[model samples]
Target: MQACRSAGLARGLGAVTLPWLWGSCRRSLSLVCAGSAPRAGDWRPSAGLGSRARRLSLSAATIVNSAPRPLQPYLRLMRLDKPIGTWLLYLPCTWSISLAAEPGCFPDWYMLSLFGTGAVLMRGAGCTINDMWDRDYDKKVARTANRPIAAGDISTLQSFVFLGGQLTLALGVLLCLNYYSIALGASSLLLVITYPLMKRITYWPQLVLGLTFNWGALLGWSAIKGSCDPSVCLPLYFSGIMWTLIYDTIYAHQDKRDDALIGLKSTALRFSENTKQWLSGFSLAMLGALGLVGVTCEQTLPYYTALAAVGAHLTRQIHTLDIHRPEDCWDKFASNRTLGLILFLGIVLGNLWKEKKTEETKKTIGSRLEN
Candidate 1:
């Protein structure tokens, strides 16, 4: 959406400004030279820096500098840095829209707009809740040690405030939908709230995430039709879930060591040695379910061709994945968003072609009848 583009720009600006502000503050602190460590009563306070201005500045600067770049923390909080999570969140809604409009034209502009809004808000809310719960553990993890919460840029109270703001936005988006869709959307909050704790008690937290993220698919269909046909939406929902499993497993590779040390459980740690095999199986399952969804919806050949592209995308992820390297793992995980969009565009095009063919056929039959 153009709005998403604009939002991205705004987010980018915020990203740039946050670091600049922090750096400036740090520079000011660095300029302050003390002849020696201050005596307890000799310290003078200025602004909010307090009596420990030097120590506070140094700590603040180190924390801010070490914090995963402002934009990154925001993105990670929204799971934007790892876009596969967003795609996995978005595709279900896409699948629901396509399926509900099956054998006809594509979903209207309103449906797409609503789903887009919901995706962004819900994704953000989910991340805020997750980071809130994981702040303590995040401080212990190498990659996450500098997160906003862990590094103290934001306090627990501030995190809850941010979370409330995100949820309010999400709720506003949900209210734009029908009663059924709203209810369905509201129902997902429980899963979202508990998702962060899933890893603490279960090795299959990724599975919980799949279920939580894919709820939008059902909401999409329910929004349009007012009720779900399990036969239609279930397979697509499950497919999205499988896709999440595959990608998030790759994601977990980046934190397996840290997770183990923190006593956190994940499929990444569960399938450490045999990650490739498990990823392959999950990838195949995702493709197969997607194929079933296409067939069930009677999608045109173009849609299948697009799905073939998705298959290739997944194949590339699998082949190029280096579970040993965290960067490679993140790259593979983030690539799923492209795959999701490819499939979504394919379905939309297929619907368009089907509509054009139907219209042409109707005109031909009318002319023959008149003749």
Candidate 2:
């Protein structure tokens, strides 16, 4: 009879609370259904979960929450629950590494592995740094209010300590590269450390983010070739920055209304009703620079084909984008990962095609000489 009463109470609560809060109420409900009502002091508010319940749908959030309690806040601080930023940062590295591969070969697996590790660490460090800087402003914004630092789950001193550890690990990764690459990679820290402040001063924070995020375009080439080939790497790097502008601008749109309320600046607010036009301009710039990369690198038909596909993909994103709807903006922003992969596939296949054509020519020459 007690269990039946508890189950009835649980159902009533579920009917009233939001979907996300239902999980929090589960523990209390479970105890009740087990025939023992939680004592008055035993009941905990949903906020006791500290924003974890709000993000239950995210797979990474699920993984983070499964860890030891002490580690969960730090993990959240690093934005591990959001892996898309890491992918965006790493994709540019893969592009340069693939392009720098010896003709007819895939990118160096060891270098790719090394850079992949660096991307995760550095991207996490970047997030930690950003959160630390933005925690105050974040608290004022609904979308960001639940962030670990903003929600008071982690202290500034604790976040600073965490940032140090992340940077130290990232430095260890950088030391594994050649001296020039090491120096080049280390220089990017300035951008990483300062980028979070850009929103407070300029509408072009996405531009600063582009400059920071695409440093990998230059670093990847130097790692593989011992130094960057300006003709090739420069164009690739430029293309990456332009691509960043397009996606990050779309990402910025999600917070623009809040940003306006709080006096923060972003391209989303700068372009306003003209955002699609600005995105189109950035897309054209990105495509043009990519074409230059293909020319400088002497990429084959497959590469250009991939380039064409990227243009179409960008076109679709801009055409269908609804800047007023944050969900649509995020979907468009996430789709750029696919865009990056398409170009990477092109670079790999293009090299193989070039190698095949070279071998065919050699065979023909050998046959003529024998005749």
Candidate 3:
């Protein structure tokens, strides 16, 4: 009699409990489903998907974002909204300019200004080309799926035309320089053209990016000197490449899962578990190259000091890197801007040191003559 009552009580409890549990699950499922309901003519990616969705704004607050709706597409196509890539592209040029200068002298500020303009134009053009080449592939990567071309916000032909305009402006910047620099600058196009394809074929696309992006190091030296000696410019170029390797690897980590899903490859995948080790190697290579660059350029102790500062910054990044977290990787990648500025300032200080030494030498010579 007791057993029968206990069973009856348990059945009554389940009868009451099942409906509530079912209702709760329905509500939870509906909440998850609400964000992805189909809409007519909607091509925008779901807000809940992907690392970029979590980390970056759905739309960047750029000049393009602020523009009239009709004109917004073109500016975004140029990526005027995000300036980090522009800085990364331009810094190598300044590095070369600073290093190529005679001891104790200012870098070519005029040329720096010109390279800045050129970097803006050329980076836009490169983005255009990358989009055009990867539009189909881009639509598959959640982070890039809404890229103007990939989202049908900009057509391929229109992108090509915009690319032409950017190239024309870049050419104008090139004309402001000498023929040697023009020739050197023109060679970079080959790298830009091939870069989008690199990810398809090799896990080392970032390596190609290192070579392509750092061409400015070579161009900067040639712009001033009309030619580059292997010894003088090579170290800067190599260091820039190593720097790219470090940062781009971090960037690749942000999209590693997506890349894997879609048959793409990156260093992020290749060094998945051992990322810090790889970053350590790249960082060492970059710093070692900078040290060699200092030796080759006859930079003083301050140059190495500045290089040490860069190393410390990279060390912190590597130490703090949470490779699995998209936000952290993006932050580390963005931190390269600070790294670039530090190195630039270091070069300036090293030159000041050289200038002081020159002044001391002149004073010693004058005193001896007077005696």
Candidate 4:
């Protein structure tokens, strides 16, 4: 009976291995593993496998895996495999830029692209800085145990050097803005450098993160308009901070157990059982501040609609969240990117609506005068 099972396994492999190999090599082999074996001379995989190969190749993990060995560790160090952080950092910039656009125009595409580039660099730098500081702590956390620095794949000295390169590149991007923006962007460095340490000393590290991560909300408007309008930029910035508090708290829950074991602190540990209540408060404050932004900017109905959508999304997130489950926490944290995009779209549409109203008002006044 054992011999018969072995023979069947070998036969199954003979039928399936060839097509799988061909697909991997040429991206054009069909997998027909369940069918009877084809005659050796006539066997050929179908082209359906190419689609699967294309999708696999497009994934960030695949790209990182395919990279040269020496570069792979650094790539992972930058968290390129996880782009949600980049989105979270960049979305506020998009919001501010869209809101700051001239009354009749779209946001500046060039500035958007430039800020996007800066977001990637600065976020990478922030990660590198964080890893360097927390490498010891990370080695004990299951989620972070395999991180490049914590796993000894990269030395602290090497990470520090890489961090310098990332910051230098980030500074180049900052220089592309006006003098005030450059000065404003430079001021954020202290926050970035210090944020990782907050986790060690206090439970409110996520608060410090909010301050660091949302600097772009202030910088984005100044980058385009040459300066910030406090009424618009301030409330927008506050709303972003509250938004960050919501998501990062959810994220911290993933490590709460490990953090407790290691004597590290986080909002997850700080809020413990009352996390839902705190999240609700933060959500309400975020919505209130966003509402203020709309009022001050004279945003249209579409903007208010988007805010309502955002409110519903957050309410669902908080209500459904299970803090004890790491996977659930991660999913909730990841979903904030969608929340960010919703608000950004709202701001863009709000600006367009305002522009349309202005055009109609001008036509009305001109026709009345001519009559």
User: Highest TM-score, which number?
Assistant: 4
TM-score of 3: 0.82
Q: Per-residue alpha-carbon lDDT of model 4 for 154-272, expressed as tens digits?
A: 99999989999999998988998999999999999999999999988999998999999899889999998899899999998898899889999999999998999998899999999
- Per-residue accuracy of model 1 over 255-301 as CA lDDT, tens digit each: 99989988999999988888888888888898888888887777887
Scanning candidate 2 in windows of ten residues, the lowest lDDT window is 25-34
Q: Residue 225 deviation, candidate 3, in Å?
A: 0.9
Q: Indicate the worst ten consecutive residues by lDDT in candidate 4.
A: 23-32
Alpha carbon lDDT at 229, candidate 3: 73
RMSD of each: 13.0, 15.7, 21.9, 15.7
Encode model 2's per-residue lDDT on 215-267: one tens digit a residue.
99999999978998989888888898999999999999999989999999999
TM-scores for every candidate against the unseen true structure? 0.76, 0.84, 0.82, 0.85
lDDT of each: 0.71, 0.79, 0.76, 0.79
The model with the greater lDDT, 1 or 3, is 3
Give candidate 4 misplaced runs (Cα > 4 Å). Answer: 1-57
Residue-by-residue lDDT tens digits, candidate 3, 1-371: 23533553454354342212110000010000011111211235556655454332232343346689977777667665555676688778878877876666666555666676677677778889989998988899888898899999988788888899989988988987889888888988999889989999999999999999899899988998989878968888999899899999999999999899989889899899999999999999989888888888889877788888999999999999999999889778877877887788788678768878987999999999999
Whole-model lDDT, model 3: 0.76
